[model samples]
Target: MSRRLITEVAGVIEAPVERVWPEIVRTVPRTELGEHVLAYQGGWWYRGEWSVTPVPGGTRLVHRVYDVAGQGWAVALANRLFIGFRERTRRSFAEGLVHLGNRLGCATRLT
Candidate 1:
């Protein structure tokens, strides 16, 4: 039995997906690269995906965290008990986008 818990955050970077892709791969070396997605799996349950999409002015980057455990309910419960899990995830993504922007020499804004 598999239950899944997911959270997603997205931002727009003022650059093309082509430009952002290499940097993402460089920054996250252990990812499984797909068309526009980078996937990372860790431990027994954690799965993370970063996807890029072309927008009018630049690229949209979305990060999603998934609990892919058979006991995902327990994982969700533990996360709830941990407090501020969602907030921390969002904050971390925001910081990451800022860092990516610095590296790319471009602007980034949460979407």
Candidate 2:
């Protein structure tokens, strides 16, 4: 069995993409650090990418995580063992972005 968990929080910044991109790279936590590929910013997780996209006025960011364990009781046990995983992950990303906006002196909206 494959077990994956994904969560995303996105918002638009008031600045242009040029200014937003570096803020993302420099401000986002090291744990969520990722590189920009084309119009998307994403990082390598165990089995997924926390991807970000550039919008007209600002950028959109996503936080995603995938936990994979092959087969049976082990997977089920692990899943049950972890609680509030999604909420915690989501909160972390959301807070990170909010903080980034504050630091950048830009307005943002969760979209």
Candidate 3:
């Protein structure tokens, strides 16, 4: 049987919704699977979403990765066991958040 794995990470950008939204829309690498929904294609059966929400002082950006079905389980196991997938993903997200901050000329607080 296949097991599903889901991971989520979020950060707050210290900028207004007006400022943050555009950069997120422009910089976040994704495929337009639907209106207001962006997807990142992952290794073999993995998929990801980049969701942005407006907050009082800034914008909250959440990234979610999902692994489903048989192929997904196999890839997730291999990545976790042999490749340290969690750490790598966290690092990548951190870097991307920093880049986004730099682009927006403000600070990004990871939560």
Alpha carbon lDDT at 11, candidate 2: 64
Write down the TM-score for model 1: 0.85
Q: Write the per-residue lDDT of candidate 2 for residues 28-70, one digit (tens) a residue.
A: 4444433552222233224434456777777776555655543
- In order of listing, the candidates' clash counts read 0, 0, 0
lDDT at 91, model 2: 73
Q: Each candidate: RMSD to true structure?
A: 2.4, 5.2, 3.4
Would you list the C-alpha lDDT of every candidate in the order shown? 0.84, 0.60, 0.75
| Order of quality (lDDT) | 1, 3, 2
Off by over 4 Å in 1: 1-3, 72-82
Worst 10 contiguous positions by lDDT, candidate 1? 70-79
The total of clashing pairs for model 2 equals: 0
Order of the predicted models by TM-score, top scorer first: 1, 3, 2
Model 1 over residues 8-109: C-alpha lDDT tens digits?
Answer: 899999999999988888886466777888888887777788989999999999988876676535756766754776678899999999999999999999
Task: Encode model 3's per-residue lDDT on 1-26: one tens digit a residue.
Answer: 24355677889998876777677678
Error of 2 at 11 (Å): 2.6
Return the top candidate by lDDT.
Answer: 1
Q: For model 3, where is the 10-residue window of minimal lDDT? A: 68-77
Runs of candidate 2 with Cα error greater than 4 angstroms are: 1-5, 28-48, 68-73
The TM-scores of all predictions, comma-separated, are 0.85, 0.64, 0.75
